[model samples]
Target chain A: MSAPDLADLIENLRRFADDRDWGRFHTPKNLAMALTGEVGELVAELQWLTPRESAAVMDDPEAGARVRAEIGDVMIYLTRLADVLGVDLIQAAQEKLADAALRYPAP
Target chain B: MSAPDLADLIENLRRFADDRDWGRFHTPKNLAMALTGEVGELVAELQWLTPRESAAVMDDPEAGARVRAEIGDVMIYLTRLADVLGVDLIQAAQEKLADAALRYPAP
Candidate 1:
C-alpha cells in the first residue's frame, strides 16, 4: 500500500469523528489539549531511558508498540487540530523549517 | 510547488540537523521533550479562548501565524523523534488509528 499522507489522515480522522458523533468534542482547543496528552504519553515511554536505551527502544517488541501507538495518537490529534483550523500541515511545517534556517544558521 | 510529504519533511529535517551539527542533540528523549514543549506552546495559544473564540482564532492573522508555527514545530519534533527511533510514522499512525477504531466503535 502507498504510504498515507497528511491529507489522508485528516480525512480518515474526520470520518472517524463523524461516525462517532465526535465533532462537537473536536474543537481546536480540545484537539490541542488531546495532542498534548498524547505527546505526554509518548514522552513517558522514553522518560527514564538513557540516550542509548531510548535510541534502541524499538528493539523491544512490546515497548516499541506502545511508543509507536503514542506517536500515532500525537499525530492524529495534531492533524485533527490543523484540519479544524484550516492549516495545511505540510505547508506550516515547510514554512517553519524555512524560518528556522535563518534563526539557526550552519557554522 | 507540490505538497511536501512526511518523507520529505524527514529528509529536510535530517539535512537541517546535519548542516547545523545538531544530530547529537536529536536523541529520542530530547526530541520527545521538544515535541512536548511545542505542544505546550500550541495549547497556550488556545488556553484562554472560549470554544467559539478558539474556533475563530485563525481569523486573526497574528494569532494564526503563531498557531501555525507552533503546529509546525510540533510536527517537526515528532517526525524527528520517529526518524531517530527508526519508526515508520505513517505506518505507526495507520496502525494506531486502526486499533482505535476497534476501541471506539460507532454507536
Candidate 2:
C-alpha cells in the first residue's frame, strides 16, 4: 500500500474497519478487552522460553507467525482505539520521540 | 505521605531520587536499559504460568515480592525519565484515561 498519510493512518484504519461493517464489533470495551487479550497472547509467545529463546521466538516458523500476528493485532486495535478516542497516535508518537531525545541525549 | 500533587507526582519521584543523589545513576539510557530489564523480570514472573497461574503470579510470596519490586523499579525509572525529559507523566496518564473513556464508553 502507498505509504498511508502517517497523520491519518489511524483514521484510515478506522475507515477500513467501517467499510467492512466491523465498527459495530469495535465497541470501546470490546476493543480494550481485545487489546488486553492480544497482550496476553504476546506474553504467551515468549512464555517458558529462555531470554535467548524469547528473543529468537520471532524467528521460528511455527511460533513466529503467532507472535507477529499478535503484535499486529495489538497495533490494529490500538490504532482503532486511538481513532475512536480522537487521539492522533502519530502526534503522540512524535511528541514521545522528542521527549526520548531529551532523555537519551548523546554523551 | 501527603497526597502528591497529581501534576507533580513524577517530579516528586525525581526529587526523591535526587535526594539520595541517585541522579547520576539515572541517565536516560541507563534508565531505559533498566526499564527493559524490569519488563523482562515482569515477564519472568508469569513465564510458564497457565492463564490462571499468570493472573495469580502476584499472590506467591516468593515470586510476588520479585514481581512487585520489579514493577516498582520500572515505575520509578519511568517517573525519573519523564521528569528529566520535561514530560508530565500525570498529564499523559490523565489524557490516556480520557482517551480510554472515549474508547470504552459504557453500554
Candidate 3:
C-alpha cells in the first residue's frame, strides 16, 4: 500500500485536532514543546545501547517497535509545528540540505 | 515548484553521506543522537519566549528563519535515522497516529 504523503498526514492531523477541539492548543510553541518531548522518547529508546547494538536495534522486535513508534511521534509533532507556522516542511528541508552541501563540500 | 518528498530527502541525505564518506558513522545510534541535537536547536529557538511570543515567532523574520532551518535539520536527521533503521517513516507515523486516535477518542 502507498503510505500517506506529507500533505495527507497534515490533513489527517488537522482532522484529529479538530475532532478533539484541540486547534486552540496547537500553537507553534506548544507543538515545538511536544516535538521535543517526542524526540526525548525517541532518544530514550537508543540511549543505553552500544553503537553496534543500537545500529542493529531493529533486529529485536520489541525494541524495534518502540523505536518505530517514537519516530512516528516525532514526525507527527514536527509536521504539525511546521504546518502551524506555514512552513512547507519538504521545502525547508531541501533548502537546508542545499546549504549544508555547500558548507561541507565533498573532498 | 514541488518540494522534495521523503524518498528524495532520503536519497539526497544518502548522497551527502556518501560524498563525505560519512556513511560509516551513520549508525542508528549516531543518527538518533544527532536528531536529539537538532531537536535541541529547534527548542532553543522557542525556549525563553513567553507562550504568546513563541506562538508568534514566525512574525519576526530572523527568528522565523532560524526556526525553519532548525526544523529542516530535525527532519533531515530523523529521516536519516528512519532510513538506517529500515523503517518506513510515513508508515510508522501512520501507525502511531492510528494508535493515538484510538487512545484519545473524541469526547
Candidate 4:
C-alpha cells in the first residue's frame, strides 16, 4: 500500500488539535519542547543497551513495537511543531541535506 | 522558503551513506539504535527544565540553535531508517495519525 502524504498528516494533526481545543497549547515553542520530551522518552527505551544490543532491539517483537510507537511519537510532535511554525517539514529537511552535502561532500 | 520534501531528504541521506560507505553500518536495527541515541542527546538539552521552562527553551538563542540542530539530527536518522527499511516516513506518520484519531477521538 502507498504511504500517507505529509500534507494530509499535518491536516489531520491540525484537526486533532483544533477538535480538542489544543491549538492554544500548540504554539511553536510548546510543540518544540514537547517534541524534545518525546525524543527523551524514545531514548530512555534504549538507555542501557550496548551499541550491539541497541542495534538488535527490533529483534524482539515487543521491543520493536514499543520502538516504532516512540518513533511515531517523535514524528507526530515534529510535524506539529513544523506545522505550527509554518515550516514545511519536507522542504526544511531537503535544505538541511543540501547543507550537509556541502559540509561532507563525497570523497 | 518551502520545507524539504521527505523523499528528497531520503535520497540525500542515501547518497551521504553510500559516499561514506556507511550503509554497511546503517541497517534498520543500527539506524534505529542510533536514532535513539540522537534522541537521547536531544533530551539532554532539556533535562533540567520544568515543563513550563521546557516550553520556553527556544527563548534563548543559543539553546534554540542547539535544539534545532539536535532536531535535524533526529530527522536525518529517522529518514535513513525509513529509507533503509523501504518505509515511507510521511505515509507511515499519516497512518499512525489515522490510528490516533480513532484512539483519541474528538470530544
Q: CA lDDT, every prediction?
A: 0.88, 0.51, 0.90, 0.71
| lDDT (10s digit) by residue, model 4, range B1-103 | 2555666677778888899888889865567667777666766877777656656667788886766666677778877876665556665666667788888
Q: TM-score of the A chain in candidate 2?
A: 0.73
Question: Quick one: best DockQ, which candidate?
Answer: 1
- TM-score (chain A only) for the predictions, listed in order: 0.94, 0.73, 0.96, 0.94
> How well is each residue in B1-107 modelled by candidate 2, as lDDT tens digits?
23333234454555555665667666544544554554455456555666555445545778755544544444444445445544444333334434444675534
CAPRI verdict on model 1? high
Worst 10 residues of 3 chain B by lDDT: B1-10
What interface RMSD does candidate 3 have?
1.0
lDDT computed for candidate 3: 0.90
- Inter-residue clash pairs, candidate 1: none
- Which residue pairs clash within candidate 2? A28-B103
For model 2, the DockQ equals 0.04
- Full ranking by TM-score: 1, 3, 4, 2
DockQ of candidate 3, scored on C-alphas against the true complex (2 decimals):
0.79
Each candidate's TM vs. the true structure? 0.96, 0.44, 0.96, 0.73
Per-model DockQ against the true two-chain complex? 0.81, 0.04, 0.79, 0.32
Ranking by lDDT: 3, 1, 4, 2
Off by over 4 Å in 3: none
